[model samples]
Target: MTLLEWPASPGFPEPLWYWVEDWHRLLLWATDQAVSDVTLQANQPVVVERHGRLFPVTRRRLAPAEVYHLTQVIYGDNAPSQLAGGQDIDCSYEIPRGRADLARYRVNMTAVRAGRERGVEITVRTIATTPPPLATLDLPPALRAGLVFEQGLVLITGPTGSGKTTLLAAIIRHLLEDPHAHRKILTYEAPIEYVYDFVPRVHASIAQHEIGVHLPSFAAGVRNSLRRKPMVILVGEARDAETITAVVDAAMTGHLVYTTSHTNSVPETLRRLVSAFPADGRDGRLADLLEALQTIVTQRLVRTTDGRRAAVREYLRFTPDLKDAILAQPPARVVAATRHLVREHGRPLTADLDALREAGRIDEREYRLFRGLGTQADAISLPLPAGPDAPEPGEADGPG
Candidate 1:
C-alpha cells in the first residue's frame, strides 16, 4: 500500500491519495470501500482534485466475490452475507487508513454488464459543496439586459447542475451594484447559497429565507413575500401552480419577480408557467404572464480553451410582439419568433462565442460546440454584453 499526500494551505485539509496503478484492482477497491449517500459514477474513471492539482485514478469491472471482499473492507467482514442475495442495493461506509483516507465520498453502487459479463460498477461523486448561490448565476445578455425594470417577471430554466442558482446570485449582485435600486429585495431558496457579505444597495434591505428549513416550500415563500412588501421577490423555483400564480400576480401587481423551471427554452418557459395552472388559470392568463415577463434566458456552460468553463446564452426580451404572441395561445411559435428578435434586440449565444473566438479568448472548437441555435457574431452583428448586461466582461448574473 502506498500513500500520496497533497500540500494543502494553512486553512485547508490535505488530500490523501491511494493510487493502485492497476485499474482492475483500483475498481475493485473502490467498489468495496464506497459508502452509501455518496454519488457513484460508472464507466468514468475515479478522478480526484485537491487544491489546484488533479489526481488520476483507474477503473475496471469487479467480480461478485471481489465486491464482497471489498464490501467487507468497507462495511466489516459480514458484508458478504448481507449482500449475497441482492443485485441492487445502496450501501456506503468510510475506511480511514493512514494518510490515504476515504471519508468524504458518498457512494452509490449498482449492477451493470459489459457485453457478456454480469459485473458490478460503482459511480462516485462528492457530497460536500458550499450551498449554491440563490441570487447570482450565469446569465445571457439578452435576458439580463434590462434588469432594472421595477415590475416584471424573469424566468430561468434548466435541469440541475445547469447553474441556475449561480445565475441568480449574479443577478442579485448586479442589482446591488446599481445606485438606483433603493427598494427592498427578498429571496426564497432551498438551503440558501451565496450569502451576501458586502453589497452597496443603500435602500434595499436583502433578506434570504430557506425553504423546508425555514418555510414549507416555494409556494409558501411566494405567499409570504407578499406580506414583506418587497420591491423585488426572488422565488427559487415557480414549480407549482400556487407559486406560478403568485409570481404572476406579483409581476402584474408591480413587484418584479424572478423564478426558474426545468424546461429547455424561453418559449417553453412561458408555456410551462401558464399551463402550470388549471384550465381556469390558463384562460387568458398566459398573456398576462407574458406581459409581466421582461425576459426569459436559457444558458449553458461549456469548457473553454483555457480548461476553464464559460457560459453561452440565448436571449429573449419581452416586446409588444412577444406579448401578443403569448396571448394567441400557440406559445410554441415563441421560439421561432425569438430568432428574429434575438437578431434584432438581443445577440444569441453564437454571437458571444464568435466574439470570444475573434478576441482569442476561446478556441474554434470550443466556440463551435456551444454555437447552439443562433447566429455567430458577424461584422454587422452588434456585440453582446460581456457577462450579464453589466458594465464589464466576465461578470455574472442570474436568469431570473
Candidate 2:
C-alpha cells in the first residue's frame, strides 16, 4: 500500500508519505518528532521510540529491498560486505545540514532470522548536536560538586539507556564552559555521539576520538591519551581488565579520569571494576581502586507524574575516611558500608525517590517500581497525599 493511502496510525504524523522514499528526510522528520531511536526491519513496520515508549511510525510493512537500500544509503556500499560476516556492526551516520551543523546518529546493523531466510535490522539512535547543560539536567548539588575533582577516577554507572553517556557529556561541557578551567580534556568514545566544537572553549580544549576507527581499543586510547598531556581523560567505558587497569592507573598518575560501567548501583560498580582483575591479586587491585576513586554516580531514569522521566541517582564521594573504611573491610561487606555512608552523607537513590514522591513529582507506583518493591498490596502501602490528584496504584504511570 502507498504511504498516503495507509490507514491512520498512532505515534506518527499524517503526512508521513512525504519522506518515506527519502531516508534522509525520514530521519529528519523523526528527529523533529523528538524520536530517540528508530528501527527498520524487513517485512515490519517502521518503529520509533520516544520517551521510552515504542510505536509504529507507519502502517505499511517495509519490503526487503527497501531495508537493503536503506542500509546502503546510511552506511555506503560496504554496508553489505561488513554484515556479510554474520556479526553485528556498530557505526555512526550523519547528514550535513549546513557548513558546521549536522544531524548525527549511532547505528547498529545486525542480521536477523526471518522464517528460514536472513533479514537485516538497523537501529538508529539520534544524538544531540550539543550536550545539555548540567543545570538543566536536574542533578543534585552534591553530585554536581563531584564533577569538579582535580585528580581521581569518577564513574557514571547505570544500565543500558539510563543516560550515563549523556551525564558524562554534560560534565565535560561543564568543564569546558568554566572560565578558569584550563584543563585539556580527551575523550575516547566507541561511536562518538556528541560533538563539543560548537561550544566556545574559553580555557579548556577537547579532542574526541572514536574506538576501532581512530584507535584500536579503549585501553590503547587511554595509554595514548597520556602522551597527549591532557589533564582530564574520558574513557568511553571500562569493560575489560586492560581498560579498567588503564583508567585506574591514569587516575593514580594525577589525571582526572572519567568513565562508565554497566552496573546499577555504586557498590555494584566498585565490585564490577575490581572483579575485572584476576583472583590472584584482586584484593590489591581493589585497594588501589579505592585509593584512586573520587566519586561514583549511579543513576536510573524514573517516570515522573508529568508523563516524562527524571533521573534518580545514588552517588558517593570518596573521602579519606571512606576510602580507609573500604580498604579495611572485607570485599563483601564494602557494599553495605558504602550504602550506609552514602545514605548518611551523600544522596541515596531511595532518598531521591522519596523526595520526588513527597514533592508530587512522581506517584506511589513509580516510587515502588524503581525501588524494586514487588507489586503486592503491601508494597505500595505508603500513604499517598490526600487529594483528587492522588494517583491510583498503577494508574497514569508512564514508561520509565
Candidate 3:
C-alpha cells in the first residue's frame, strides 16, 4: 500500500503524513477515544529522527468522500474506488514521501462499519515502537544475562498489555549491544510492536517481518528464519500449536529462540505450551519442549499512588531441577520450586509486591490486588534490614 502525497495542512509543526500523537490530541478535541481500530496508513512529510528512529507524524478525519479521492490519486485508476458504494471498505494506502525518502511510518488503512453507513476515519497504530532499555527491566541479574546466552526456548509469559513485548525488546537489545556476539536477529511480530533502538554490530543484521504485512503467521516467520541463517530468532507471541511447534523447532535446531505467552506463572506457561499439541502428540512434543525450554518470566503492571506505573515481575531461571520436572511433564511443581528458590535472593512477584508494599512504593490496597489478595487482607510484609543502610517503610531508595 502507498500513502498519498497530500498537501501539508499549514497548521501543524511539520509537513505530515500521519502520527498517533496527532490522533491522541485530535481525539481529545473530537470524541476522546471514540475511534475504532481501523485506519488509513500514510507517511509524514516531516522527518524527525531520534536514536536511529524516525517518528513519522500523520493525521486523518471523517471524510469518506475525500478518502475516495485520495485513494484514487495514490493508487491511480486501479484503486478500490468501486468498493465505496459496496457498504464496508477495507484496504491500505500510503503517500510516496516524494521518492528517495525512506518512510518512518507505514500507515495501515481499513474502514470501520458504522451500521448502515460507514464513516472513513484513519487510525494509525504503532507500526514500529522503540521500547525502553534492558537495564530498566529491573530483572534479577541472573535472569537478565542468563536468558540470552542459553540456546533454548526462553519465554516471557504475560497477558496482553503486561509488558511482554517490551521485555522481549529489552532482551533483544541486550544481545545486540554485546560486541563479540555477531548474530543475525530475526523477528516475527503480529503488527510488529516493539522496535529496537541500540544495536551495535558491524556484521549483525536484524530482520523484522510483520504477520499480515510480511508473512502469514508466526509459524511461517520462524520457519523462514531458519533458512535466513540466523543466530537469534524472536517470535512475538507463541499463542497457538503451529507457532509453538515452529518456535520449539527453531530452538531445537541449536538456535537461540525467544518467544512469549499469556500465562501468569512459570508452570502455567510450560503447561500451556506443552498442552498446545494434540492429545496424541502431547508426550513427544512435551519432551521436545522441555528439552528446549530455557526460562520463563511473568510480568504485571502495577500503579503507584502518584498515577505512574511500574513492572513487578518474577522469573523462573531454568535450572537442572526445574528442567527435570518439566521433562517429566509434571508442570504443577514449577511455581512451588521457583518460589522456594526466589525467596533466598531471587525475586518473585509476591516478594516484589510485598517489598513494594513495605516500602510504600505501592500502597497496601494496590499491593494486595497485585498479590491476588482482597482489600480485607494485609499483603504487605514489614521486612527490612536494621543498619543505617536500611530504608524506611513507604520509601524505596530516594524518598517517596
Highest-scoring model, TM-score = 2
TM-score winner between 1 and 3, please give it.
3
> Each model's TM-score, in the order given?
0.60, 0.87, 0.65
Tens digits of per-residue lDDT for model 3, 106-217: 2333444544654343443322235566887677777776677647888887776566877888778767776777888999876665556434556567888888679988
After superposing candidate 3, which stretches have Cα over 4 Å from the reference? Answer: 1-129, 196-198, 328-346, 373-400
Model 2 spans with C-alpha error above 4 angstroms: 1-21, 373-400
Ranking by lDDT: 2, 3, 1
lDDT comparison, 1 vs 3, better candidate:
3
For residues 257-347, what per-residue lDDT tens digits would candidate 1 score against the true structure?
9888886556446556766766655656666677688877766665555444566665677877756653543333443444445666665
lDDT of each: 0.57, 0.79, 0.59
Clashing pairs in 2: none
- Go through the candidates in order and give the C-alpha RMSD of each one to the true structure: 11.3, 8.7, 11.7
Q: Residue 266 CA error for candidate 3 (Å)?
A: 1.0
lDDT of 2 by residue, 175-272 (tens): 99989999999999988998997887789899999998999999999999999999999999999999999999999999999999998777667767
lDDT of 2 at 171: 90
Ranking by TM-score: 2, 3, 1
Regions of model 1 farther than 4 Å from truth: 1-144, 177-179, 278-283, 325-334, 359-368, 372-400
